[model samples]
Target: MENTRNVLDFFQKIVKEEPDVSAAVAAIRTLMNILENFGDGETLRGLSEELRKATEEMKKAECSITSVQSGCELFQRFITLTSLEQSNFKDCKEIMKKRGEIFLRKLQEARPKIARLGAPFILDGHKILTHSKSRVVLQTLVEAAVISKKRFHVFITESHPDLSGVAMRDELLKHSIGSTLILDSAMGYVMESVDLVLVGAEGVVESGGIINKIGTYTMALCAKEMHKPFYVLAESFKFVRLYPLNQRDLPQELKFSSTIIESNHSNLLDQHPQVDYTPPGYLTLLFTDLGILTPSAVSDELIKLYL
Candidate 1:
């Protein structure tokens, strides 16, 4: 049980990495290390049980779609290890190590491919608006601006309570990309001038909608109202089996209780939500490692990968 808790803690800790994918990747590497340290059958069972517990723990912690999906992916690999032992393959450690490598390589290879595929949509002179920060979104913008020389201005919402948008603005500046930060409520005010909307997803549900930062739905609604195309830049791993008809169906982990107000203003300090779902109709396309996908095509992709 102790080891199980440690495994869960390790996954949750690494998930705090700036880009959600980096956090997922870090957790995968740490899991690899954990597997590498286990050489015998008896302790391996403990680790295997711990892996199952870790996945459950992830659900409670509200890990992002990629992390939870990757946990499932890892569990599949664990099944392979057990199968190998039954087949009398004695070098179990070596087999597990190789499996981990294949999985890690698959994840590492996805980021750049997604960026490259998504970059072309950011044409010259396009003023793109994004809510919250996403490493994939940032990388796509950078790829378009730097390597492709696509000159454009980026407008970001100051994703409140966390202000992850500030980090995004700074990152854009670091890459020599131009960006402007705006207050969350000012989205509609600026919507008319924006050519497109680009945002990252915590999870892309089976309904062809995305679960992203709290303001994403509002931003999408505004974009939809203005006839502006809203694009979601995400990897396939962020796709999940959930089909939420409304916000309440989402897991509790997606919400946060920040002490936004304190002391004298104690009564005003209500909990803040961290994410919300944007229906498929609000999005124009999803740029993923699987290529440019229509909102409705998300389910097909999920079926292709998981089934």
Candidate 2:
């Protein structure tokens, strides 16, 4: 329990400096670990209360440090933290649904600016390509489609192992939005005809690199080769400070998952891959809730937040 509290405190310190999804997630995960490891009902309740207070403090700090759009991202982070810390599974699901709603609201608020100033202008019948599933990007496109009063064709990559793009396709279909699901390998072939590429990041480092679901870096490489515009939609909180120390030491964390190591057969081991890193230069623009930033600008942004 002491070790768990120490980890939680470490995450909280990071959150105080960089109020992004990564830090918020770390905090939430640490809290969840405490609950999972120490199964005392009263203690769990006390930790939950403490986490709730921390979340509120994080929010107040975020609003003070960033713009309204950034504030929205902070709110989403809080909602995510709250949802994860919920003791009841049913309540967690309900909170997740509400979190999605809050995310949608934030995306809606930033749509006009993102369409006009963030991404390149799309012609009347332009097709936009996207990889994986991003609620933020999806909501942005939906808002664009509605504002344009015309169909905006979207090509979505069927993210493998997860196939989250399937969910993206279904959501688009329900909204009567035009969309096509393509194999992840087909991204390069389809790049030439697509107007722009939009992706979401799980984390963005001060060095301008980003961490996302597997296949994002490949897409960015393709976009770079094709001279196509590739944009990342992420909140500033995702920005991390990753500097090497003493030329011999570097910060690293091991993410262990049974899902990755244990499979039905050894032959099928390579089938399920998770996580990839996208270098910053390949990204043309990062559309944050704060505003648009070039990949080069990420370091400066992080400095402002960290220093």
Candidate 3:
């Protein structure tokens, strides 16, 4: 249990220190730490089990673990691939540590690559509508304003419960980009004013749809009704093997926070869902490190990585 607490502490420290880092990437870094500190007596299987247990413990903590699951799973796969055909256990461990560093470097590069690809979409005088606070979305807007020298306005939702969108608005202001914070219920009202919708995802499912902060679907629906384009900015590492036909299809762990799930509240209606699914049909295009991809193209990329 002490080790579990240590693992959770490490994960939380990474998040607290680097607010821009995604929870998924923090989880990956924590797992990498486990590999780096592995003892010489530990077997390969034991190390894998340790990483698996750390992931489960993280999910139980009072935080969002939606993308963490996918990140940890992909990192585990990379470790397995690195472990193949190694006679000496010590040599295999060393190889995994080296390869893990490379994997992490690639992930760090994904955000800038995605930002560059997404920045061009924010043309001068264009108004972008984004929900919640996405590091990728934030980086893209910064890139457009700082690098591309484009002048654009942004409409951000006052994402409820956390009101993370307000922080997004403030961050934009820091970059000298004009932005407005509107109520969550005002998505339809603001739809006509914005030229396009851009959002960051917690996970990009197999259906090419996205699981993101709550109210993302509402924004997408409004964008669809108004004939405005809806774009998603996400890293390819966030692609999870989920195919949800509707909101109910999402797992409880993904929808609710760890605290809410553990509670035995008599009125279940009081429990708020942290995330929602936006179907592929509503999305215009996805800006990823892999390049601009249609909704249908997400599955192709997922197949390449997962299959």
lDDT of each: 0.76, 0.62, 0.89
Query: What value does the lDDT take at residue 76 in candidate 2?
Result: 40
Backbone clash total for model 1 is 0
Query: Least lDDT summed over 10 consecutive residues: which range in candidate 2?
Result: 247-256
Q: Model 2, range 160-228, lDDT digits (tens) per residue?
A: 867989988988887888999999999988999998888877566667777666788799899999999
> Which structure is stronger by lDDT: 1 or 2?
1
In model 2, where do residues sit more than 4 Å from their true spots?
A: 1-120, 243-273
For candidate 3, report its TM-score: 0.96
Number of the top candidate by TM-score?
A: 3
Ranking by TM-score: 3, 1, 2
lDDT for model 2 comes to 0.62
Off by over 4 Å in 1: 12-21, 43-47, 58-66, 69-86, 89-93, 256-270
- lDDT, residue 266, candidate 1: 44
Candidate 1 lowest-lDDT run of ten: 256-265
After TM-score superposition, what is the CA distance of residue 156 in candidate 1 from its true location, in Å?
0.6
Ranking by lDDT: 3, 1, 2
